[model samples]
Target: MLRNMLTRDELIQWMRTELPRLLQEDPAFRAQVIGILSEALVSKGELTRLLDELRAMREESQRRFEAADRRFEAIVEELRAMRADFERRFEEVDRRFEAADRRFEAIVEEMRAMRADFERRFEEVDRRFEAVDRRFEAADRRFEAIVEELRTLRSDFEQWVRFSQQEFAALRVRVAEMGIGLGSLGLRMGQGLEEVIRQVIESFSGAGPLKAARLVLIDEAGELYQPGARVEIDALVTDGRRFLVEVKNYAKTDEVWAFHRKARFAEAKLGETFEKVLIAPAATASAVALAKQLGIICYTFRAAESRETSE
Candidate 1:
């Protein structure tokens, strides 16, 4: 019973080592042991049952292992495919990054060009402003020069006006002095003529069959006389109509004929005939002859008579 109840490893060892020994011991013993072993086999049928169960478990395990192996192979193939996809995506990302870099470089170059253009425009504007400032300065200088010239011209004009006024005043004074001198000379000549005529009339007053003698002088063409000259006789006298004396002061021999003619014209104007006498300090021979032919009396004080009268 103990032998039959052996543990599984022990029972497998007994079957391997002791089963042959029991058979070599006797034939009849072997047959009897075989019969007993058949009984023991009946009793130990748990081993066969265990073996069948093991076989069933092994087949199930093998099917499970093969299925697991196929699943692992499928998982490995998927991982390889995922690696290939990742490599392709990485290349595409690199290409995108390179394009973005080129665009960024282009933008930087455009900015640099804009900055250069702005600098050039600023310089041009500065130059134009400087030129405008210079023109303004020149205009200011010209205005100042014009003002200075106008001031000088005004000063000169004022001086010239003053000089002209002074000169005009001096000329007016000179003209007035000349007029006064001429007036004085004319007055002196008139006075001298009056004195001589008065002396002659006094000398002749007592002589001559002339009882209350008359004196007359006439001036014709009086307009021809010089300014301030006396052409009219200073004295005129008249008695009863028997005789008429015409007296003239002669400064030139050429004037004697003119005087004689004027005296004769007066006789015709008097409307009554009368004896005529001419009196003068000097007369031409023709004047004397003409007087005689007309039966006109003439008189002059000789040097001897003049001296005798003075003594």
Candidate 2:
């Protein structure tokens, strides 16, 4: 008959109870079972040893895997730190570049402003220069006008001087002709006076000749006379004053008796109280001395002759 194989738990329980029972009931079977059991125990010990070895190998593999995992984590942390450092450095470099760009842009703007300011100043300077040039042109025009006016004035002055010189020359010629005519008329008048003076002298010789004679005459109504005549009159009058007259026309005398006679006649005409007698055509030194003693005045026609003479 086939016996039932024990279940794992039931076989473990049956081997504990039945193996002891079979040993008690059958010695030979008990010995064979014991030997098999001993063999099974040996096999189980070997399996336990193998299992422990496998568990030790698994623990060693886990330890090695864990260590490798920790090393990998450290390497990952290092890589992350390096990546963070690189990113921060890149950000700093970018910020610096941005700041530099802003500075460069500001500098460019400043340069543009400077250029504009310079252009404005240059334009102002150009305008000022243009104004100066205009002023210079105006001044030049004024100076030219002044020069033209001066030239005109000089020409007028020269013309005036020339005209004045011509007028002066004509005036001088007219004056010379007037002088020559006056001198010729004077010579003719002197030539016509000779006989009239002789008649006057003959009238004075009559007895009891007047103490004074008055004759009022205009310039051109006199009778004509000769160039040389001498007349003595007892009395003559001019402006109501009685004077003894000795008329002379181109007659000169140095005789002292002639002047003494004139003074004596003046004394008789004035009743011995006459101051002087006039002797025309002034006498020489001896005549002047006698005239001085007898109280006679003497004059000459030389002044009238000088007036009639031509230059």
Candidate maximizing lDDT: 1
Per-model TM-score versus the true fold:
0.28, 0.25
lDDT of 2 by residue, 124-146 (tens): 99999999999999999999999
Highest TM-score: give the candidate number: 1
TM-score of the candidate numbered 2? 0.25
lDDT score, candidate 2, position 171 = 71
| Cand. 1 Cα-lDDT | 0.59
lDDT per residue for candidate 1 within 225-284, as digits (tens), equals 443334332233334434455554321223444445545555554666655555654445
Instruction: Report lDDT (CA) for all predictions.
Output: 0.59, 0.58
Residue 15 accuracy (lDDT) in model 1: 82
Clashing pairs in 1: none
Q: Which 10 successive residues of model 2 have the least lDDT summed?
A: 215-224
Clashes per candidate, residues 3 or more apart or on different chains = 0, 6
